[model samples]
Target: MLFRHFYNRLPLQLLSIRKHFLTNKQNYTVIKNTQTYHNYNIIPDVFDEAPNEPLIIQFKNGIEVDYGNILQPKDVLEPPIIQWEHDAKKYYTLCMLDVDLPTRLEPILRSFQLWFVGNILGQNYMETGETYANYIGIGPPKNTGYHRYVIFVCEQKNKIDYSPLIKGDLMLPRYRNHFNYKEFSKQYNLGIPIAGNFFLAQYDETVPKVYKKLNNLSLFVTPLK
Candidate 1:
């Protein structure tokens, strides 16, 4: 009964035990809070698996076409010699879209068919495919912001007819704005693009007159916008 007598004579270490437990509890709460903050700031790598192929387009002037590069309408009035490494197994159709330069009068952005030549052996554009729509010179209104002109080279599933569009009278006002390049490609049996590029162009005084003349062509046909 000596141990029982010592227990009754001594105060138990309950306060010391409670203090140790509380310290550990606070440390654990701090660690959990820090871990949650760390997780919130972490960003996962999502685009690591994406394709890194480059689509290159250059002008005769030796200047490479890039997005946001300032250029004039006359500079590209004549089509640029477009180049892209093809998948030797299949021939592709070359489609170009001149995404319109927005004007104060018409703030809604639109795109027009600059060139929609299809069918070709290799890259011999002059030798093949129906030249459905001819290239139209850029004519953004004076003071309008730069226009984005995009060129898309798409894959052809089969030979497609562009006769209905080509044979019709080409008018600017009718076909100028709101041309859906992607839809047109789909309608013609052309699938996703093999390659693409774009450049920018701003407006000048002659733009209005040029657009008017384009609209007033004698062989004008009511465009299916």
Candidate 2:
């Protein structure tokens, strides 16, 4: 009876030991699996549907501009215009401008330009030029009569501080005293390029040639006075 009792206790002890060993192994395996999963499964290689282009918004009055493509004073110029500015106080800044494109087309145009500039030109406007009187002309399809008025907001690769002065040459020297080229270059090199751009196109309403083809069509029918 004593031998049988001892034998039974021995088996129980061995079973307990085996249970403890298996539990510890399972815990270790769980820890190892967690680490492996975090290292291999959770890390992302690229952003998921991240913005491939800048954000563009248009305001009422047919003016289109983007805000994401802002250029600091150190971008490249070979790629062309990066940002835009307009003199009309009503639509001067991004905050002030109101969207004018067709409801369905507004978002499309904005996104298209944002992606187009971001991928192709690699730059965008950082700040709006402060010259209130600046204006540029846009001719017809071939520079014909009654040209269109275009306001351009060009982005420069260098930082400019146009304070106190109202109007001057659009060259860097005009604002050289206010800019820090060394610091500007450091920031410029790190810049992702202009992230916003805009343009305002206004046409003459009274020009007869504006709708000459339409007028010819009307000649074939009864014209509305």
Candidate 3:
């Protein structure tokens, strides 16, 4: 004679098993199914860890851009540096060091460059204008490594018409020969480059949108441990 044992609810038993597996953090392993596996102790948690201060960007030209002031959440305004100390104190917990480039910070720097370039062109709508979409390359080219971050405070020869295509907007093949670097130097009347540079900035993972909007400016906060 054959005998069998049955459970009242097999599905419910399996559901509870899955729930327990998910909820029990200590029982999980990287190689649970392996016959031989190694388990290591997890690192202890740390809170409010301070990152290396004064994040530095070393340009290919050997210049560095340092954010002159520490970054805070309040620095999101038109003149972010006005209440620097107070905001830093209040939001120190939220602040993190600005470190290497991340995908999130790319857009912020692009936006900043768009505005800076637009300001050169005497237009405020550069953000929404086709200028940003047309002119800017997404990131530096391969094998070029990291490009130098240079700030140009230039005065144009004529008030650039926002409607016409910008000089930088032309395709590399077509306009590469016509950039007129000499004319740019003559029109703008630039002096010898400054000796050193710095900018103070902060970043927070919680505020991703701020990074997206201001990525062009190269503002970012490094993630904490």
Candidate 4:
């Protein structure tokens, strides 16, 4: 019985150590009240896994999002306009994930999915698609640090049946994190994204509002002093 108990406790001990290591290395700096800039030439982290391709994504407000452009929470209130090389008849999958979770610190560091739309016509996010998940604007908690919102467009070999992925009832707030985009892409054979872009969002007044609008879901809540 003692051996069995020790084995069971081993995983927890390793996890604790891992979290401690990551917490020290993870960059969780808060960028408050600073001039926002856009770098259209930046490259996203996801590109390291796949070859970079030209995929243009622009917000309705006329801002062209490249790899890692610095954008405000208000900048993404609406969906962005897409421009791809494929014809309109082709279908693709649109996915967004937060890559800045602070390791596996309970809820501290987990993937936050901002959007996921499947079976959409090429270069158009407006029509003929299954909305597996609705878009939620960035809501990084105050003092929680900055986050990178990476958007990807995966070209499907064929029209994918999203029924399997939709099995779990959408869980608000929690759905924003604990997602495994790498696994999801591989499981569904979605392959690497043909085009991708990313933006950074820091905690601000708009963050609380973004959380409130999303049914008061917040992974990290700053306690009132």
Clashing pairs counted in every model:
0, 25, 16, 3
Model 3 Cα lDDT, one tens digit per residue, 117-151: 32222222223222322222122222222222222
Candidate 1 vs 3: which has more lDDT: 1
Cα lDDT computed for each candidate against the true fold = 0.56, 0.26, 0.27, 0.64
Order of candidate numbers by lDDT, starting with the best: 4, 1, 3, 2
Off by over 4 Å in 4: 1-48, 102-109, 167-171, 219-225
Write down the TM-score of every candidate: 0.62, 0.20, 0.26, 0.70
- Which is the better candidate, 1 or 2, if ranked by TM-score? 1
Clashing pairs in 4: 101-109, 102-109, 112-176
Please write out the lDDT profile of model 1 over residues 43-110, one tens digit for every residue: 11101111122247665576677534677776666667777767554667776655543542343545
Tens-digit lDDT track of model 4 for 1-225: 998887667888797877886885423211110111123212222332532454577886698775556787777777777766676778899887666653212345456667889998776677787888787666766565556777778888788888776655454565455677667778888766776656777666676666666577564444222
Best by TM-score: 4
Q: Which candidate is the best by lDDT?
A: 4
Which candidate do you rate higher for TM-score, 1 or 4? 4
Off by over 4 Å in 3: 1-67, 79-100, 103-114, 117-152, 162-198, 211-225
> What's the candidate order when arranged by decreasing TM-score?
4, 1, 3, 2
